[model samples]
Target: MNLLKKRWLLLTAACVINLCAGSIYAWSVFAPPLAERLSLITGTAVTAGSLAAAFSLANGIAPIPMILGGWINDRFGPRAIIPAGGIVMGLGFYLAATAVTPLELILGYGLGFGLGLGLVYGSSVNTTLKFFPDHRGLAGGIATAVYGLSSVILPPVAHALIETEGIEAALLTLGGVFAIVIVAGGLLLEKCPDAFAKQFTAAAPGKQMAAEECDWRGMLRSTRFPPMVALMLCGAIPGMMIISHCWSLAKDVVGLDAAAASAMVSMLALANVFGRLLVGALSDKFGRLASLSGALILTILATVLLSLSDQNAHLLFSAGILAIGLSFGAFMGIYPGFTAEEFGAKNNSVNYGIMFSGFSVAGFAGPMAMNMLKEAGMSYQTICLLAGTLAILGLGFAYLFVRAKKAAYS
Candidate 1:
C-alpha cells in the first residue's frame, strides 16, 4: 500500500485495537459480578473497594510492560509486540473468567491484562505519533481517543452481557473477540516509511526552528522532566478514582439504580472521548501547557462539584462526572504531544514510557486511598476533596513545566 493509505489505515486499525484494550475502563461493570461470584465460591463477603484495588493494581503493573514494550518497539517495531500483547490480554481475560478468588482476579485481570494493555497501548500511540510528527497532537489524540471511547461502547455491552449470559461468559466472549481484532490490527500496523518520514520532516523549519531532540537519559537530566512527571502523577489521580469507583459512588452516593449507574459510566466515557479529540486539536493551536493548565483547572472544579452534589441532585452529579471524565481524557490526549514537544520524538516510545510511570503511581495512590478511606468509614466527599487538592498541585507543577520549557527554548 502507498504511504498515505498506509498511515490512515494504521490509524484506523490502531483505534480499533485500542478499543479492545479499552475494556479495562469497563471494569466498574465487572466489579459487582466478580465480587458476587467470589462471594459465592469463598463464602466470604467481597467489597467494591477490594475489587477497585485490583483495578488499581492492574494500572500499577502497566508501566513494566509499557517501558519494556516501548524499548522493544524502538528496536524491532510494533508488529511483534502488538500481537503478543493481544495473546497475553486474551489469556488474562480467560483466566479472569474462571477465577474464584480475589488474588486470582488480581493476577489475571490486574497484572496479566495490564501488561498486555501497556504493550499494545504504548505501541499503537507511539507509532501514530511517529507517523504524524507535524500533527503530533491530533494524531496522538485520534489514536488515544478510541481507548477512552471504548469505555463508552463497552460498558453497556458488558453490562448487557453480564445480565444475560453471565459474567464468565461475557468475559470469555470479549476475550475471544478482542484477541482476533487486536491481532488483525497488529498485522496491519507499520512504522512510517523513510520517504514519508522525510516528507513530514521537511515541512518543519530547519533544525533551529524545530524542538530539540533529547534522548531518555538527556531528558531525565533536564529540569523539566521531574515536574512534568509530577504533573502527570497528580493529574491522573482524579481520573483513576472516577474510572475505577464511579459506578459504586453513583449507585451508593447518588442513589442511582444499577442501570443508571451503568449509564453514567457510559456518559463519562462519552465525555472522555470528546475531551481527547478536542484537547488534542486545541493543544495544536493554543499550546500544550496552556491547554493542560486549563484542563487541570477544570478537574479541580469537577471534583469540588462532585463532592458537593448528593443523591438528590442527579443532574449536578452527572455534570461532575462529565467534567472529570473530560479532564482525564484531555490529560491523556495532551501527553503524547507534550512528551514529543518537550523531549523529542525519536526516543518517544521509551521517553514517554518512563514518563508513564506516573500513571502507575497514580494508579496505586488513587484506588488505595479510596479503598482505605471507605474501609475506615470515611465519606466519599473526602476522596473528592483530596482529589481536588491533588489537581491543584498538578496545576502548580504544570506552571513550573511551562516556565522551564520557556527558559530552555528562550
Candidate 2:
C-alpha cells in the first residue's frame, strides 16, 4: 500500500491502542469496588479517601516514565515501546487485582500502571503527530478525543463487569484485553518515513510552517517555553478543578440528586470530546495561540457563570460545566500540535512530554486550591470567582506567550 494509506491505518491503530490506555480514567469505577475488596482482605476500613494518595501518586509519577518513553520512541521507534508499555500496564492491573493491602495497591496500580500509561500514551500521541505534520491539529484532536472519550465508554462496561464478575475478575479481564489490543496495535505501527514531511508541507494550506527542529533541551532554553508552560497551567487549573469535583459540585451547588449529578458528569465529558475536535480543527484554520486564547475567554465566562449559579440556576450551572469542559478539551487538543509547531516534530515526543509537566502541575494545584478554599469556609461562589480571576491571569500569560513566540521565532 502507499504511504498515505499506511499512515491512515497507523492512525487508526493508534486510536484503538489509546482507547485501551485511556482506561486510567475509569479509575472512579474501580476505586470503590477495589477499596471494598482491599478492606475485606486487610480487615481494615479502606475508604476512597485512603486510596486518594494512590490515585494522586498514579498521576503525579507518570511524567517521569513519559519522558523516558519519549526519548526511547525518538531513538528506537514506537513499536517496541508501545508493546512494552502495554505489558507493564496490564501487569499493574493484574497485580492490583491480587493486592492484599493499600501499599500493594499503590505499588501495583499507582507506580506500575501509571508508568506504563505514560509510556503508551506519550508514544501513541507523538507517533500520530509525526505522521501528520500537515494536519497536526486535526490528527491530535482525533487522537486525544478518543483518549478523553474512553472514560465515558469504559465506565458503564466496567460497572457491569464489576457487578457480574466481581472486582478481581473485572480487573483481570480488562487487563488482558488491554494488553492484547495494545500489542496488536504496536505491531502495525512504523516510524514516519523521512521523506514524508517533504512530500506534504509541514502546515495546512493557510497555516504557518513549523519551526526548525529543536531537541528537548533546546526547546526548554527558548524564550517561549516559560510562557507556553504558564499558558497551559492557566488553562488547565479551572478545568482540573471542575473535572475533579463535577459530580459533587452538581449535587452541592446545583441541588441535583445522585442520578442527575451523574448525568451532568456525562454531559461534561461529551462537551470535552466535542471541544477537542472543534478547537483542534479551528486551530488548523486560525492558529494555535488564537484558538487557545479563545478557549481562555470561554473559561473566564464559564467560571463567572459558575460563581453566579445557585440552587435555582441549574441551567446556568450546566452551561458553566459545558463551557469549562470545552475550554479544557480545547487546551488538551491544541497543545500537542502547538508544541510540534513551535519546537519541530523531530523531537516532539520528548518535547511534548516536557510540555505536559505544566498539566501535571495544574492537576495537583487545581484540586488542592479547591479543597483548601472549601476548608477555609469559603462558599462555592467564592471558589468559582477565584477560578475566574485565574482565567483572566491566564489570558495575560497567553499574551506573554504570543509576544515571546514572536521575539524568539522572528
Winner by TM-score: 2
Q: How much is 124 displaced in model 2, in angstroms?
A: 0.3
Count backbone clashes in candidate 2: 0
Task: Write one digit per residue (lDDT tens) for candidate 2, span 346-381.
Answer: 888899999987889999999889999999999888
List the RMSD of every prediction in angstroms. Answer: 3.5, 1.4
Steric overlap count per candidate? 0, 0
lDDT of 1 at 330: 84
lDDT of 1 at 260: 91
Cα lDDT tens digits for candidate 1, 270-293: 888888898887777777777788
Candidate 2, RMSD to the unseen true structure? 1.4
Query: Best-fitting candidate, measured by lDDT?
Result: 2
Stretches off by above 4 angstroms in model 1 are: 30-54, 98-105, 159-169, 201-210, 241-262, 307-315, 370-386
**Residue 395 accuracy (lDDT) in model 1:** 81
| Model 1 C-alpha RMSD to native | 3.5
What are the models' TM-scores? 0.85, 0.97
